[model samples]
Target: MSTDPAEAAILSTLAARGPSKSISYAEAAKALAGNPPDDSWHKSMHPIRLAAQRLARAGQIEILRKGKPIDPDNLHGVLRLRLKEQPE
Candidate 1:
């Protein structure tokens, strides 16, 4: 488990974005964008995907397919994430 700041930032941003009607890899890339060129969207994608998967497994979030969350959902398809609130 690498705790790279950039990866952590990406995960935190996604969690903060809340549950959307739909979310794409491009959207995630955009959310993690920094300065132009320096903030290359493509470079951040792989890490973002990995982070999302890890978060999903930990039950911190649910990845939805066709507007619903389920394992049968296609991994290659677009996803909408639902974030779980921290217990008080």
Candidate 2:
């Protein structure tokens, strides 16, 4: 699997944030530091969103919409993500 530095960094930050749930793109960008892939925060945000989507699909994280948990909220809309618990 090809690892994306930006995606990795964002995931790490999410792991660190933990529990409370839901993160905004602006907040994520600031936490990652240095602009994302495309240099423009606007353009760069797409990968971060994609990473979150992928993680959610793999059951590694939960995606939220307006604070309530949901699956695949509209991509063009605002997104919020939280880590998922591993099966015990």
Best by lDDT: 2
- Across 1-88, the per-residue lDDT of candidate 1 in tens digits comes to 3376444654666656654434565566666665443457788787767776776777666677776775522466666555655667
- Evaluated at residue 6, the lDDT of candidate 2 is 51
* lDDT of each candidate versus the true structure: 0.61, 0.65
After TM-score superposition, the amount by which residue 72's alpha carbon in candidate 1 deviates from its true location, in angstroms, is 9.4
Q: Candidate 2 — number of clashing residue pairs?
A: 0
lDDT of 2: 0.65
Collision pairs in model 2 = none
Off by over 4 Å in 1: 1-7, 18-22, 35-39, 72-74, 85-88
Quote each prediction's TM-score: 0.62, 0.69
